[model samples]
Target: MARAKNVLWIMCDQLRYDYLGCTGHPSLKTPNIDAMAKRGVLFTNAYVQSPICGPSRMSFYTGRYMRSHGSHWNGWPLRVGEPTLGDHLKKIGVRNVLVGKTHMAPDLEGMKMLGIPPESIIGVHVAECGFEPYERDDGLHPTGRPRPKYDEYLRQQGFEATNPWEHWANSGAADDGSLQNGWLLVHADKAARVPDEHSETPYMTRRAMDFISEAETDGTPWCLHLSYIKPHWPYIAPEPYASMYSTADMIPVIRSERERQNPHPVFGAYMDMRYSRNMARDDAREKVIPTYMGLISQIDDQMGVLMKFLEARGLLETTMIVFTSDHGDYLGDHWMGEKDLFHEQSAKIPLIIIDPSREADATRGTRSDALVEAIDLAPTFVDYFGGKVPAHILEGRSLLPLLRGPTPPDWRKVAFSEYDYAMQDVRLKLNQPIERCRLFMVFDGRWKYIHASGFRPMLYDLETDPQEFVDRGDDPDCAGIIARLQAELFDWALHPNDHITTPREKIAAYADNQLQVKGGILIGIWDEAELAAIRDKIDQRAKM
Candidate 1:
C-alpha cells in the first residue's frame, strides 16, 4: 500500500463521540463530518489518556500516556526531550504544522536551566508541542495576557473592544445593546455579536486553509493540525448557527436522582461544584445545550469548507485526513459539567481517519470497535510516513493495521484513562492530600472500573447499565471483577514508560551477555582457555 503525501489532522475541543450525526446523534446535523466518516474509518471505542484538555492533548502529541508524559493537568508543560509526532515525522521529511490550539504550556524552567532561548528553532518546537505554529491560539483568553493576533484581526475588521474575544466573539448583545457575557448559562442561547465569518471557528478554519496553501507552495510534505476551540465553552454561536437549534433539539440530560442522593465521596464533591450543579438544572440545560449544538453545527460547516478547499487545490487525493477531539464535555452526564472524569461522555472521543492510500479503500465507511487511545495518533503518523516507531518512547501502537485491514489479534483489550483532581475544589471537599487526588480508570469493553486513590473504587457493568447510572463500587458481589480490573491497572502502571533512552533490543543483548564480551577485561575468565571460550562465543567481526 502507498502512503499519502500529507496528513490533515483536524481536531475539535470538547466534542463528544456521540454528538456527531454519523455517531448516532439524532438531532445534531453534522453532514460534513458524517461525510468524512463515510469516506474513512470511524472508531467507536476511542478514549483519551486524560479527560482534561492539557494532559489529554499532551498524551496525543507525545504518543505516551499522561503518566508517562508527566503533564498531569492544564497549564502544565510537557518536559523537553520528549519526542512528539513532529519529531518522528521530521525524520522522514514531513513537517508538522499547527494553525490552532494545542494547550501546550512551554517548559520555561527547563528551557532556562538548559540556557535555551524560546526563539531558538529547537526551543520553539518544544514550546509549540513539536509543531511549527502558523498561528497558535488556545482560544480561552479571558483576561490578563498580551493581546492576541485574533484581537488585532477583530480590530482590523472594525470590531472595537479591549478584549474582542470576550466582547464581539464570545459575548451576546442584549435588547438594550448591552454586552451579555457568554460565560453565563442565561446568555448561552444568545448569538455572539460578531459575524459568523469573524468567529473563532471560522477564523481558525481560514488560517488552516492559508497554512495548507503556503505548505504546498513551499513544496514540503506537511501535517497540519487544524484544531478548533468551539463546541467548548462560552457556549455562544454566531448568527445563523446560534439560531439553528432550539431546546427541543437538545438530548435528555443523562443525570438521575439516584446520582444526586448519597453519591460516592469524590463523585458527590464534583456534583456539588458550581458548574456541575448548574448543568444539573433543567433551566441551564435548556439554555446551554442548544447553543452547544449550534457551536458544533458551525464546526461541521467549517469542516465542509476545509474539505472543499482541499479538493479544489488537488490536495484531497494526496492528504490523509483525520478528524477527532481531544476530550469530551460531560454536559451534565453523570452529574458533571466539564471533563475530568472516567465517564464515556468525558473520555471517549470521536476518531475518524481517512487514509488516502488504496489499501484503505476497502475499509471506507466501516466502523471499528477496537480499544483505541488518543496517544495512538503519533505512532500512526510516524508509521504512515515510513518512519519506524520508537517502541521504547511511544507506548501506543500504530492504528494503521486497524485502519487498513483486520485488527491485530494481540490488540489491546482494555482502554485506560486518568484524572488528576488535585487542582479542583473536589479535592478540598474530600479533604484529600495532593497525592491522593488521583483517579485511574480501566474499561474492558463491558465493565468500567475506577480506582480512586483516597476513596472506594467505582465500578459499573456497562453490559447491564450502558448509561453508567448505577455505581456498583460498594457491591460485594462485584469484588472479584474489581480486583481483576485493578490488576489490569497495576500491570499497566508497572510498564517502564520512562525508560526511553535504551532500546529494548540493546537491553536484551546485554541480558544475553552480549555487552562488550569481546573486550580483554572479561571478569569471569580464570585462564587463557576460559577467555578463549568466551571470545569464541562472541561475534568478533571487524574490530578495526
Candidate 2:
C-alpha cells in the first residue's frame, strides 16, 4: 500500500469522548465524525497529556508530554527550541500549515535568552506553535489580546460594533431590544447574532477548504492543521442550530451525591469553584447544555460540508483525515464545569484516524481499546509520510501499525494525564504553594489512580465504580494496587526529553563500537568462515 500523500488534522475544542454517536452518545448527532470513524480506526480510550487547551495541544503538536514541553496552562508559552509536529514533518519534506487557532503563547523570554530575533523566520514559526500560519485565529479575541484579522473581516461584513466578537459573533438579541452576551446564564438559550456563514466555525471551515484547494495546485505533501474554536465557550449557535437541541435532548449529568460528599481535598476544591458550583444547579445546566449541544451539532454539519468538499476535489482519497479534540468539557459532569480532573469526563477524548492508504482497509470500521495518548499524533503523521520516528525527541509511539489493522505487541498498557491549577485563585485559598498545586493520573483500563501534590492520593476501581463515586486510595486492601500504579507513575515521571544536547543516534553509535577497540575481545565473528576470513587478513598483516 502507498503512503498517505497529505494529512488533514481537524481539531475541535473541548469536545468529550462520548459526545459523538460513534462513541455512544445517546442523542447528539455527529454523523460526519461517526462516518469518518467507520472509514478508519477509532481509539476508544484516548487521553490527553493535560486536560487544558494550550498544554494538551502542545503535547499533540510536539509529540511530548506536558512536562517535556513545559507549557503547563492556557496563555503559557511553549519554550523556544522545542521540536513540534511541524518541525518533524518538515524534516521529511512535508509542509505543515495552520488554518486556525493553536492557543499558543510565544516564549519571549526564551527568544531573548537565545538571541533569536522576533523578526526572523524561525522566530515567527516558534511564535505560531511551530506551524507556518496560513490564517491564524485563536478565536478568543474578546478575552485575550485583540485579533485584528477576524475583527476586520467581521467589520467588512458590516457587523459594525466595538467588539464584534462579543456583540455579534457570540451574543444574541432579545425581543425587548436587550443584548444577550451568551456567557450569562440568563442568555444561555439565545441564538448567536451572527449569520451562520460568518460564525467562527463555518468561517474556519471555508478557510480550510480554500487552503486545500490551493495546496492541491502544488503537488507537495502538505499537512494542514485545521483547528476550530467552537463548542467551547459562548456556546451559542446560529439560526437552525440554536433551535436544534432542546433541554429535553440534553444528556443526564453524570454525577452523584457520593461524589460531591467527602471528596478528596483537591477534588473538593474544584467542586467548590464557581464554575463547578454554578453548573451544579439544574436550572443553569438546562439553560446552557442545549446551547452546548447546538454548537456541537453545528460543528458536525460543517464537518459534512468539509468532507463533501474534499471528496469533490478528489483529495479525500489521498489525504489522511485525523479528528480529535484538545480535551473534554465537564459540563457539570462529576460535579465540575471545566476540565482539569482525572475523571474520564475530563481527560478522555475521541480519536479517529482515517488513513486513505489501502493498508488501513483491514482496520476500517473497527475500534481499538488500546491506551492511546494525544501526543501520539506527531509520530503517527511522521510515520504516515514514511519517515523514521525520532524516538528520542518524540516520546510517543506511532499509531501507523494499529491503523494498518494489527496492534503492536508492545503497545502501551497505561494511559496518563496531568493537571496544574496552582495559578488559580482556588489554590491560594487552599493554601497550597504553586509547586505543590499539581496532580498526576494513571489509568490501566480498569483501575485508575490520582496523585496530588501535598495531598492524599485517590484511587477508583473502574471495574467496580466506573462513575468514580468511590475513593479507594485509603483502603487497606487496595495497598498493593496503589503501590503498583504509583510505581508506573514514577517510571513515567522519570523519562522526559528534557536534555537535547545529543541525538539518540550519536549515543547509540558508540554502544557496540566501544567494545571493538584495539585491546578488546574479538567479537565480530559470526561463523568459522567469517573467522577464517578475519584470520587471513590478520596473518597477512603480521607477515607484512
Candidate 3:
C-alpha cells in the first residue's frame, strides 16, 4: 500500500461520542460516518485535553495540554511560535487549507456569548495554526434575525445574569427547541440557514471541497480541513434533521445510583450549580438526548452530502478522511448543559480515521479501546502525509503505530488527559469563583486520579466504576494509588506549558499565527503591557 497523499480532516464542534451511531448509538443514524468507521478504524476511548472549544482545538494543533499551550479557556490563541499539523504538513509538500471556525479567540473574555469576553483571537489563532487560505464564520448568531439578539433575549426574560453575552447563550436560546425541551430550548424557526454574507460553514465547506478537488490533480498531496459549527450551540438544525429524532426514542437518563461509590466534591458541586439553573434532575437527560442526537444526525447528513460529492468525482478512495470533534457536550449530563468540568460526558470526543491506502487488515471495522488524545491527531496526520515530526517533542504520540496493530511493549500503556478549568478559565471570566476553580484530573487507561489545585484530591476505578460517580483520590485506604498517580500529576503540573517555541523568542509562532514572548511574556492585545507591569508588581509581592 502506498501512502495517502490527500487527507480530509472533518471536525464538528462539541460532538459527543455516544451521540453518534458509528460510536454505538443505535438510535442515531450516521450512515456516512458509520460507514466510514466500518471501512476505517474507530478509537472507542478518545478524550480531549480540555472539555471546551478553543483549548481542545489548540491541543489538537499544538499537541500540548491546555495549560501547557496557555489556552486554558475559550478565546486564547496559540502563542505565535506554537507548532501545528498544518505547519508540519506544508513541510512534506502538503498545502494546508482551513475552513470554518477554529475557536482560538485571544482571551476568555471574548466568549461573552459563551461566558467569554467581548473580543476573540480568531485571526491570531488562524495565523498561528499555520493553515493558509483561511476562512472563518462570524462569532455571532446564525439567524438573519441577527442571532435573535442574545442581549435582547436576556432582557425579554428579565434575566439579571450579569454578563449579557453569557446570559443569552445560557438562556433557552441555546437549545434546539421542541415540545420535549419545555422552556429549556429556545424555539427559533427563523434561525436556520447560513446566510451568504455571514454563513461560514456552508461557504467554507464548498470552498474546502473545491480545494480537495483541485488538489487531487496538482500532484501535491494536500490536507483540507472542513470544520462545521452546527451541532454545537444555538442547536437549530434545518428541517427534517431538526425534527428527526423524538424524545420518546431518545435514550433516557443513565445514572446508576447503585453503581455510585465515592464522588468528587467539585464534580458534585458543578452539577448542583446546573440544577440551580433550569436544568432538572428528573428525566432531563431524556429530553436533551433527542435534541443532541438530532444535531449530530444533522451534521451527519451534511457529511453524507460531502462524501457524495467526493465519490462522485472518484476522490474517495485516494483520500484519507478523518472524522472527529473538538470536544464533547454535556447535553444535560449530571444536571449540566455545557462543556468544562472533568466528567466523561464533557471530556470524551470521537476519533475515526479512514486511510484508503491501508491494507485490508487495517481497513476493517475493527474497534480499538486504546486511549487516544486530541493532541495525538497532529502527529497522526503528519505521519500519514509523510512529513517529519517537528523537533517540538509534542506531548502526544503518533497513532501510526496504533493503526499498525499490536501496541509496542514499551509504548506508554496509559493515555493521559488534563484540564485546568478552575484556575485560568475562572480568572478569564471576571467574578468567577476564584477558590472553586481548582480541579485537575489525570486519567490512565484503567484508573483516574483527580487532584483539585487547592482542595482534597479524588480517585476513581474506571473499570469498576466506569461512570466516575465515585472518588477515591483522598481515600485513606487508597493512599498507595494516590501517591503513584500524584507523582505523574505533579510532574505534569510543573512541566513548562510550551511545546513549539520560535527561533526568535521575541516572535512566538502559532499554527498560521504568531505571538511575541520577547519579554518572556505574552498578553492580550489590550492591556498586555499593562498586565505585564502588573504581573511584575505581583512578582515583587511573591518575593516579599
Indicate which candidate wins on TM-score: 1
lDDT per residue, candidate 3, 1-544, as tens digits?
Answer: 3434677889988888787877777688988788888877898888888777777888887777766777766655565445667667766777777776666543323333344223234444345366654455424342321222333444555644444333333233334552222224434222333222223344456767767667656667777777777577655444455466776666655454532334454555555554323343445544455656666776676677788898897777778788998877766655566777666777888888877665535536878777788878777778776666653546777777777676556765555565655544233443436545655667777788777765678777989988766666666898988888889777777864453453333343233233345688574646768766766765776577
Q: What is candidate 3's CA lDDT for residue 425? A: 29
lDDT winner, 1 or 2 = 1
- State residue 438's C-alpha deviation in candidate 1, in Å: 0.5
Model 1 RMSD in Å is 2.3
Once superposed on the true structure, which residue ranges of model 1 sit more than 4 Å away at CA? Answer: 1-4, 144-147, 513-515, 528-532, 539-544
C-alpha positional error of residue 99 in candidate 1 after TM-score superposition, expressed in Å = 0.8
Of 1 and 3, the candidate ahead on lDDT is: 1
Best by lDDT: 1
| lDDT, candidate 2, 500-533, per-residue tens | 6677887875562433445765676678887777
- Indicate whether candidate 1 or candidate 2 has the larger TM-score: 1
**Ranking of models by TM-score:** 1, 2, 3
